[model samples]
Target: MGVKEGSVLPDKNQQESYIDKQFLAAPVKSAVDKFQLIPEFLKVRGLVKQHLDSFNYFVRTEIKKIVRANDLIISRVDQSIYLRYKDVWIGEPSVIMDGVTEKLSPHKCRLSDITYAAPIYVNIEYITGSHVQKTLVAKNNVIIGRMPIMLRSCCCALYGKDEAELARLGECPLDPGGYFVIKGTEKVILIQEQLSKNRIIIDTDKKGCIQASVMSSTEATKSKTVIRMEKEKIYLYLNQFTPKVPIMAVMKAMGMESDQEVVQMVGRDPRYGALLLPSIEECASQNVYTQHQALEFLEKKVKKSPYFSSPLEKEGRALGILRDVFIANIPVRQNNFRAKCIYVAVMLRRMMEAILNKDAMDDKVEDYCNIPKNLYGPQ
Candidate 1:
């Protein structure tokens, strides 16, 4: 007889539940007893599983933070699911449900909840040799000036991906100014911003000068307070003074016969004037007669100029031209070439001294005569 149209089909859910119950009940018939298994399986394994679970949760949370505020669309193909975040697509293990396929629509999905906004500002600073002045202010989204502000010692405020690692190792040199609002920390951010804005303003001034008003503070009756903001021209004065060279050395180097001549020569040369006088005064402190002896010895040393084969030959060739001029009795301009000749004579003396002193040669005349006669005059 044919089945009736209203007859009910066997329940698939009941069959699956029966199979599962049978499998569980039949599991006690194993050849190996449960008590005979390794004890670590119950303790260490359980702890390991728990630790793995915690680690997995941490990783998932961190990944979620990275992908938050971003939509993820996924598609299943074979053994893998192709996941897409914005324009990026990735593949991972996944399962398919029944014969149905679900696709994420770009327009319907919402972004993850992870996102942050950061505000950037400009910092301005005026720096001299010994002092630093700083200011910080907001910046608009436009280039109002063409000139860039001068930063004495400036660098970016942001620490990139490696900053944390570097900090952990105590290798990071970043100034944690704006990141914290503590007493000294607050100033870093404020100063950086101020310097940035000041540069922009300076660029806009057309004269390359910062004309912005800076806030100043003054001591009051009970407390310190901001008095007023005033605009001032920034000035940085560098120390240009240098200590002078010793008088004995100057006399020796110049082949000067007297201290007066050394002073005159130094005064004539601005380079020498800045260094020679002080050095001479210091050297004079050793002994009065020794100072004079040093000068005379230096002068004698200066008279014996050394002649190198290469440079001396070249100089000799040039001097040959001058010697010809002198031989021709041509009135060469003395003042223009006199100082140059004197410098050459001094250098020659120093060169000779360097070589002879190294060899422990006491006789200056003997060594002086050994130099090429063509380059140096007859001994």
Candidate 2:
């Protein structure tokens, strides 16, 4: 039969290879071939591109959010005297000398043995004095501090400059600039790798106890919550909450009062019920069956904190710890802890799984595999 127009013919080599393919007993691959595309990728996006991007984000966006988060500052002695940050920004690279301000360059800074940095300006509103004569003042473009500028960042003098311009500025055209020039010294910050935040990890501890841990992180706070099995009973461990608490007690404190409700929330599996029996009995042994009773029990176990001065303030200490400190990333709005309670339940279920199946626990190598890393900067 004749081949039709616009029809494709398979390559004889490809067809033959596919038909005669033999599976390898061992998986073997070429390392050079595996990374061959890296250079091409780096050509388009330079090696230090991420660092520059991160620094630029910090200067342009993250700093503003940080300022807004900590915007208000009240005088300790006089509550009425306060300062509020309106806005913040990173100015162009510059230097002040002999009552003269001049544009600064990385080359000049290197030769002069000075840091190539930019000025941080902030707009603020403040009330001066607590008396009736107190005045509200608004200020703009006030120099707050100097921040080290990453070379080739948006704020850098050499940014967006061509090779000829770079040559005039005494900068190497091939130098991928992501380091800070402090006192004429080049400092490259190594990116730090760590376990991801707001993630639950189930693993076995050195003491042979299986535990579920979550490094909860939020804009306001960062905390860790751990649910571990010890002596066939589950306990909750969180910093600032002295002494290990029974898992059932913590569940009840978060308003899961009924044992059946707690068990059902964990799972419908009968194994979960059997595993949670010891923790539930421990809660009962301590007379922490009701939510009120659980709160009161936790209140006594709370470590003394500077925040709680009076008995009225201390009354809500346990509730505050649960709402703010424990699994802090899971926000509890208006004292509603439904989400937090569910998270704890999930942690408990994961802990049970780890205890039941050794393979269910996290592998140390695998745990580090996908961790997010960050270059040292404002963050």
Candidate 3:
């Protein structure tokens, strides 16, 4: 075909139009023209701000929660002999020299090849006498242990110090401190990312069976609870239990005796009920038809402890383990397992969904945008 005169010739205006349309350009401004916020952000929250915040939270709040979880210690031999922790606090860093206690600084710890740590003190009330003549003794500022101090944290001596003050203490004034001095060695804890806690994660196991898991974390306990299908039956795997326990049996032990109630709790969908039927039948096959029978069945399955040997004690210990360790993120108050049973049912529902829809199953290795990554300080 013969080319048009303007298209073949490519006039000056057409050439300009072609350039403008094919290659677009915009005015470029220097970074100085765009207000710099990074410097200001650095000044407000330094590079190590996350580490410092985590350490401060650990010291001021987490430590108290940890202490409160194990506040009372009762002797096994003599129940009357017990110790109650009233309060706990971290003391200022100090060292004893020639029987004289002197304040310790991070610089001194580095030079002396010592750890920069503070003493953890607790107030305690205890019974120190016979059961018939028990005497309650209260103690104050009892030293329990030493905790390494994270520099620049709220509990650190240099937390709010100015440049001149930091220089006076032989520290780098420009240092963004979020590390520990351990035996004269500077230790920096890098942030680590892991699967979320107390959230249901549905994935397939090595055996190609759909599973739902939770990394349950509480003040007193941290455990992994998983419910997976095996040969058409659901099973629970927890550290405190034996190899595995039937999911329905676990529910029944948690006061969910009726299989119909368990199915309903999971969902009204027929697909969910179908997936749970095998587990329910498995529980029945084991003769676990009631809460007491379920507990008795689990009593033998729980890891045996030397502390609980008697029949009654064993039964109670088994129930206690289930209540305290199984899906521990859900609180079991006053021996109530209603919430825990519901949580298990939800896990089951998720697993059933994964089975029904392959896309519903979360990949073992997931995208960063789909997961939460949290930075934590040293324990």
Candidate 4:
């Protein structure tokens, strides 16, 4: 019979002598092969000189991106502030050495108690008084600021040097350098791990109740949104809602009108079905079954609180929050009720899974509400 497709066939490249394959024995009692194996307790630490190449590359490339992302604006009264940055560059240090400009050396910085850094310059242009466009500010390069350089990096003075050249600069031949010089001291940048921002994280409390939270942050605003389960009821804590608002009210405001859909979204079985009963019953009792009614309920809640000055302003702000509450880091219509429905469904799924799977309750936690920082030395 022919071999069927999708079957694992034995490889035909095996090559072994009869004596070697049939029996294996050591040539000597304590013999070892030099190229055969390595020990399990051995560790491999990265070379510092090797890391300098990569770190310097990031400083040159990523610094430009960081600067462009946060560009500065200087308004001018005499001339229009039309000048904007085009490109950024790193140049040699302009420190005066016998009335001549020269590149900074790591040894020189170590002896002088100064930093080993280079000048950062930018190419800029703007319109002049004649309404003509694109004029440079200076005859030559324009200096912006200084950037610290890593020792033995691509732009370092000792880079690409031979033994004689390295000795000429007063550096040890065996030294592998990857550090910053400041005030005649060597500083090494350590790695830091942080929690991801602007996303939902589901966790269980000590009582086994599920909590879904998101740290919402933008350039100008930051708020922590939390939805927690307590006493068999789901509540949402958000801005301007002094009393925790019902998650069902939020769902209804997002246009999930049918209680059947909400209950079925949670699950159809008896155990899961019980989780949605209280929320659905509360939604029904409040008479907030339609989108318009839900918006009015939210408006009333916001207006009843003492935060807003007038009814009209409170109503407007409540409406805005009802429409734009569930999204961040992306642009969409302000009142995209469909997106909110999807978000509600996902949150419900997380809670349902946490309730059904007992094993999931003890899963590892990545709750980085506050990070711990360690101090290395006696300082």
The global C-alpha lDDT for each of the candidates, from Candidate 1 onward, is 0.29, 0.86, 0.84, 0.65
lDDT of model 1 at position 245 = 23
Instruction: Write candidate 1's Cα lDDT for 202-308 as tens digits.
Output: 11134422222112111111111111111221111111101222334433322344555554643454544333444455545634234345443332322222442
Question: Using TM-score as the measure, which candidate wins?
Answer: 3
- Rank by lDDT, highest first: 2, 3, 4, 1
TM-score of each: 0.14, 0.84, 0.87, 0.54
Model 4 misplaced regions, further than 4 Å: 1-102, 119-146, 152-165, 173-176, 196-201, 205-209, 213-226, 235-344, 362-379
Q: Residues 1-379, candidate 3, lDDT per residue (tens digit)?
A: 8887677676899888777643335543667734575687788988988887878888889889988998999987787899999999999987767988788899999999998998899999999976678899999999989899988877788988998999999999888888999999999877767777778889887878888999888789899998989999999998888998999888888899888899899999998888888888888889899999998898789886787766656657678888788888898899889988888888888889888888887764665533555655533
* Root mean square deviation (Cα) for candidate 3: 10.9
Model 2 C-alpha lDDT per residue in residues 277-359, reported as the tens digit of each score: 98889888998889999999998889887867767768788998898889998988988989988888898888888777878
The best candidate in terms of lDDT: 2
- Model 2 scores worst on lDDT over the 10 consecutive residues at 19-28
Error of 3 at 188 (Å): 0.8
Instruction: Please list all clashing residue pairs in model 2, or write none if there are none.
Output: none
What's the CA error at residue 222 for candidate 1, in Å?
A: 77
lDDT (tens digit, per residue) of candidate 4 on 1-379: 9999899765555433334643356443343652343342222433563366466655567656655744545444434655666677777643656987766788888898888888878876654554455454532367788877777777678778888999999999767777778777888876444334566667776776687766664433356666777778888777666567788887787777777777776666777668877877787798888868887777766635564566554656665665544444322365666665666666676766676675444233354443222111100
TM-score for candidate 1, residues paired by index: 0.14
Misplaced by over 4 Å in model 1 are 1-247, 250-257, 266-271, 288-292, 295-341, 344-379
